[model samples]
Target: MNRREWGLTTLAGLTGLALPRATSAQSAGTGRGYRYVHLDVFTDRRLAGNQLLVFVQPAGLDTDAMQALTRESNYSECTFVWPPEQPGTDHRVRIFGRTAEMPFAGHPTIGTAFALAHAGVLKPAMSKTVFGLGVGPTHIDLEWKGRQLAFAWMTQLKPTFGKTVDDAGGLAAAIGLEKDAVIRPAQEVHTGSTFLIVPLATRKAVDAAVLDRAKVDAVLTAAGVQRRGLYVFSTERGQDDATAYSRLLGSGGIEDPATGSAAGPAGSYAVKHGLVPSDRAASIIFLQGVLVRRPSRIHVNVASAGSEIASVKVGGTSVVVGEGSMSV
Candidate 1:
């Protein structure tokens, strides 16, 4: 489909969903308020990707208020954009999960860039923007199809390969998969965020896997990587355009539809382990969130310099679904 046709189809699909409405009760009182934009990240169509809420003008909102709003929305993550405190950055974005603030996250970073552009804070002529995240300065490159933002890519930190877990049976059981389904030993990888990358045998194995939180935590804790979550993936692709199928199961068995932070490391791991050709630049597409009905397609590009990974970039498209305001 053409760009216009694709945009219209996405709009039509999301129109029926409830748009954000101002909280009249809170607006009536002395409570402060902030405007927010709703977005679906990592998908061209609406309502099918990971959801994000972005507060475009969150001047008065404190940390407590941001955390409260994140819990209220119950989305995987939310972002509050602030004036840049550092040099050469466009804005400073604070990302918050359902319960606490995060150092950095994938969907929120790209989704917030789209949100800023949609809100007119970013001009169409501007092709790039940098966000000062908790992890430090994060650079985002923008691609525009005419005036519309077609895609955004975030350059993540260099990959740090950590401990390798030798307990294949324990790792498999943690995610309710058979030991035979594991194709290789699990290893910890960090690119801003940390995830234990588990190589599974097939797409069916990835989809069939379920998170056993207690067991998974036990395995991670034993490896001295208790803070990291499980990122199970199979290089065997069920979709023609994808290189892999994957899932991110965090503590409490919560599954993220799309994980941008993990995608960088995932691509790095793929190139290092020969899952993808390492002779040249590698571009990998990961299909995730299908099991939860919210499908997300994440793109990763890895540049190799000799035996080392030169750079890692994670990117995707996002749709601005809805908008509204809430009291802070």
Candidate 2:
């Protein structure tokens, strides 16, 4: 079948695999084989979260090969795990989206940790495991959720808050929404990577959002907000613990089921902007991808020192959907 028929037009020329499947080339004893696993992150239930593919012990693979594999997987993001180059770190992870590499992302971090534990590379205990990433060392605390499942809490970087868009009407139209759909000024926040956080008035407005890529690109370029994507959110909660509903539209037109990286800064934004009570620690749950049928629940914890934000943590569970070997 052609790339168009396979629903994989993003990397057809680069990867040469449209809706690629795993291909085994090296045997186990070759010492050059790679084991890849697919994971459903931010959800305990199977097949109901952001999909992540992790390539274990990606030895002998160069950047081009890694990017090819990621594009082939067709997941929102994929990771290559390696031994840490930095001292006192357990592992090193290189994150890649369908079209490019990412400094840091939420679900990939949580899912990668879960995959490591599942493969016996890292034991699932009460302690934390730190991975040296492109952004820096990221920490994850793990606990057993069931006989076959685990939950991971990942600590993200301290937010470097950025500018807030004053022209709400222009911002809304840029993303193909009505003027009044934008509830407030859109703010830029970067935990490790940057994203424009747009607040919509209602859940319907959020669900109705359609990105005109040209307009979005033009707006972002003019605003000097250099980042991968935009995160549109509403105060309307669809679940009990959910504080809001969110959707992330990034480069390559990838819509994330749940975005962990954005959640960290978003949680901090809630505290800083007083969207939620800023009196104490806050737990914010973001519901996403319901419109796409792959529902995800992301847990975000934000702590503050009075008016100042202290730290932000993003956590969730993941389930291994499939595992196989890949040939380099």
Candidate 3:
């Protein structure tokens, strides 16, 4: 094991003492340590997409421990599952990024539902699993191919348009691109969390782009864009002609392989700016994280009723890569 894995294994040993027994082993009796499943989301193929770790039954790990565990996993995001606190809910999920907890995130919620169903904790016959997230009850629809879970689609919260950065020159400098490279004004939109939506001139600009944290912070601060996630997309797309090539840059200089949360707001931004037709049901294929070698494909669907957006849904396939037990 590498240093992080070794540290996680050691923490797993202690997690058994901190949390109550949910189950022992894979079945029967009570258990201490939490079982975690690792999966690659937004891609059907293994080793692509974004890496996510889901703690199947985190009974006792508090905020600090969850944050620490997320840092140790070093993945884009980690999730913890608990029994639902409200009626008509399948589970309660808490999402954590590398350094902090998030109210809502796209891949973690989807991946956690897949992990739960794969573990037999969630019923295969159930078509939808409602996770009580910090934002609210977010529903994920499941597809079954025989007895196995084949696909998952999440209905995100409504889009809330935030600030708009009209200073295209300043915004271009923030993310390592030319003034002519920015196609649209930088927009801040939120579904559950906020993201600065940037439209680039071409796929090459999206690919060659590098993040200057100082400039990025300066631009965001100047525009009053509180959310630090930067999402840039190009119409030229990747791997497919219909796809929109995209990348999501976190505050720590980490680029997300596939960003579901940002996808929702991006769809709204596109429709709002007439980048994509919103006359009817529309779908945008997002190809992201290729420069980092973890190519991910995110399918973003938007339904519009006239000028207003009816709903936004994000869906993708995932495959289990690994599984282990984590102590508190």
User: What's the true lDDT of residue 45 in model 1?
Assistant: 94
**Error at 203, model 1, angstroms:** 0.8
Candidate 2: which pairs clash?
none
**Can you give the TM-score per candidate against the true fold?**
0.88, 0.84, 0.85
Per-model clash counts, in order, read 0, 0, 5
Which lDDT tens digits does candidate 2 get at residues 1-328?
8867676655555577465554564233344557888899999888899998898878889999899888777777899999998997889999998788888889999999888877878764446888998888988887775434467898888888898777788879987788988877778898887878888888888888888778876776777766446788887756456788888864454567888888877777777777767544456788988877889989888887766777888998898998987665
Which candidate has the highest TM-score of all? 1
Best candidate according to lDDT: 1
RMSD of 3: 8.2
Kindly provide the TM-score of model 2 when superposed on the true structure, using C-alpha atoms: 0.84
TM-score, model 3 to reference: 0.85
Model 3, poorest ten-residue lDDT window?
A: 22-31
Question: Which portions of model 2 miss their true places by more than 4 Å?
Answer: 1-32, 146-149, 217-228, 250-253, 279-281
Per-residue error (Å), model 1, residue 174: 2.8
CA RMSD, predictions in order: 5.8, 9.3, 8.2
Q: How high is the CA lDDT of each candidate model?
A: 0.88, 0.81, 0.83
